[model samples]
Target: MTPAAPETIAPGVLRLTAPNPGPMTGPGTNSYVVGTGPCVIVDPGVDDDTHLEALVAAAPGAIEAVLVTHAHPDHTGGARRLAARLGVPVRGCDLALAQPYDPDHRVDAPLADGDVLDLGAVTLETVHTPGHAADHLCFFAREARLLLAGDTVMADVTVVILPPDGSMSDYLASIARLQAMPIDAIAPGHGRRLDEPAATLAHIVAHREQREAQVRDALAAGPTTARAIAARLYPDLDPRLTGMAATQVEAHLIRLAENGEAARDGESWRAGN
Candidate 1:
């Protein structure tokens, strides 16, 4: 399902949908525009001509900088093309691929806990919410108490924990960090906007805990593989989804092993004290 063109979410922010659809669910990626004068574009979505045109049409002449949440192809694919068209610097924690970004581009801007981007009318505070990826970030609007959550917190599905790049421990820590923030609304990377922001965070936290418990139980029953643990945990889930769930389970197992709750013996895994 191709999503509609760019739509305004607030007075100064517009959400644009990319044309590329993923393998599972979610029809398109989301790109966001913030502020009017000296505007900032976040997560330019997939590299598609239509999505780029839509973003250009929506922002017009005021585009100042492009900000990416992470280095994933879905999110950062259009950054170079869009930045080139706008003749503006593309800024993100990760370096822009292929072409060298403009000297004005702030790649190492040091996005610590309370760093804020004052984009004329609106101010976006950066929260280093890693785990979806090492360089992931979430922007927050203090006035509206709204969180522009990247893949760190999606509405419909769980983000992949592609290890070395992603970590289950960091993901849980990031969720706890966001839960502590005074947020009222959540504009996720995918699916519909979340109304009950706090409740949503709570649900995600609880769900992860439940999955961890299931993994623990499966290990206790007998020496099990990650695939076996995932099968037991998600018994009624689709066959295709099991592969993704297994990746998640493996991440959990790695975390558990690190914490001394589980151990690996060559190909097999077992519960530990």
Candidate 2:
């Protein structure tokens, strides 16, 4: 598939794919410019000079607000610099989201659930979807019913849930909530846009559930670490991605423990009581 590019996707939505494509960031981070006259930028990809110029040039006219979907550096690193150049306030679920990864990312406003940013022609309603990242937010466009699903839902691959901070149970619930919404299509953080949001969301939920079952079976053998279970379930997975696979296994283990389906013994997990 083609990487993200600078193009008008909908009536008032613009997509610009940064050049930082890799395993973590599928086709790099997808930066979206929403609205016509005064636009709201969501997840300005990287902090590179080239990407910043493309974003500013591809934008409509004046940048009213700069919005970050989550705290990941690839998504929010350019937000502060772009905001500074445009002289607009940076908005996000929390200012602290950008602090740890990017100290220079200055957040001017915090977006709460149900908060709406009206840009005359188009309006963006914030939906707090925290699973991939605790502070992840998806913006719903009222007119096109397009969901600017950050890393919460990827356009190509399934959303990767990082454990400890990212919860499998919470991610499942968040996706369920999104399925209930009036989403026509998903403009994800990576890859191309996804259609039939309902089907896609359902598949994601079911896919996670299947993986949870596989982890349970892996645990049935004996007490094991998350990495061990990941190896058992995905033995052929790429070496570099084994860590991510382990994290996902750990997330399922945590959810299973919470549901009394699995028991934890320090770093090792066994079948629940």
Candidate 3:
């Protein structure tokens, strides 16, 4: 049975919810369909028959391609299955990571910065905004000035910065790139539509900056660890979230150390004066 169709965000764009939901989460992962004819599906979301059917039903007829923003399972789980059902090819970054999604399906196209995808009359421009994940990308509607931001810019919690694949430096640069664009609306991957795009972007930037400052302050208090910084910065947060916070804190610390704003002595950290 097909899952219920997602709410309409624009004239032809629809946002479908994935089946997977983790702890400390609101709503669920979002899969978007842009255009009605020869539609483009973004982030097919987790592997679920219901969700896949819902997505197919939402955009009947031709499904030109399935586009993934990142390789995260929550985002690309259904790419292979959906693409096969629609007889179209999957397109995205990190094809290796996406291989496990479906054995038969291949990444037909590589998504990069400034690539324009025609979805009927509407055109979606691909903006490579890595950080949440190295392969992360966002789609911008030039005519509507709307951004279908993947996990890179969610309305709920800030996207995680997993090392090796994730970089704080790249994430900040991506945010700045988005800020430089003419975005009026943000259709996030996991939350309600954001009308004031500029204000929302500002708030996200300010929040990250404040967290960086807090990390510096924690380092200044004497030799401290990422866990210590997280504790100091989020005293009231749940203990389970401390680990995630520490990861973020560590990302900031690493970035600061690279810039000479902070340094590590042995096993402890200290901020430069």
Candidate 4:
């Protein structure tokens, strides 16, 4: 699919929305080009050839570096290919920590939470927000007061927190961390840009809290499996999304267990001390 022309979203930021749209990825993944003369590309989107060419064409200057918010396929799939094409390095979190563990998902330069990528016009600071994915990172353009929030915060959908790699507690902490920052707008991984950072973050937190309450209540009834709890809570859920719902339920249960509010019994969860 052909990507629309790059739109200038900020002072020196151009947004190129890829063409791999779906229920999870609303209007496809957003790839941002920051700065001029020597630009920095963030989240290269999918591995489609057309999208790769679009990314290259979107940049007004030489592509300095390809920055990945995480190693998720939808975000980092075309990162290496794009970097290789431009002879630039792909920088992101340690690949060893990435989910679905792909050895081919290369990161030439590993970025830490406090690391900064100076792009002359603006500096994009890394903010490690692990919840939706273990290696998720959000880029904060302090000068613009715009956060390049990957899957950590979406414009229209709640991020899925799948356990084993994702944690509800960690997600909340990440949200709080962002809340403490002076952000004016959020360039999320999906959908339109969020202008109300404070209200958006608060709403996300409140929704999670409400869902956790529902999860806790579901558990209090009796020891049950994550799938069972999801079935009880999401009666009108689409069959295709049942698994995702169950995974989210398990993540919530894991957080509850961590807080000593719930206990795990083999494959089931029950109320605890």
Model 1 scores what on Cα lDDT? 0.78
Instruction: Give residue 12's lDDT in candidate 2 (0 to 100).
Output: 85
Residue lDDT tens for model 4, 38-59: 8888998888888788878878
lDDT of 2 by residue, 202-221 (tens): 88988998998899888888
TM per prediction: 0.89, 0.94, 0.91, 0.96
Weakest 10 consecutive residues, lDDT, candidate 1? Answer: 95-104
| lDDT on C-alpha atoms for all candidate structures | 0.78, 0.85, 0.80, 0.88
Candidate 3: pairs in clash? none
Alpha-carbon lDDT of model 4: 0.88
What is candidate 3's lDDT per residue for 115-226, written digit by digit as tens?
A: 9987775689989897877777899977778899988888767877866567889899999999999998999888788999888888888988988888877877788888
TM-score ranking from best candidate downward: 4, 2, 3, 1
For model 2 the TM-score comes to: 0.94
The most accurate candidate by lDDT is 4
Worst 10 residues of 3 by lDDT: 97-106
Candidates 1 and 3 compared: the better one by lDDT is 3
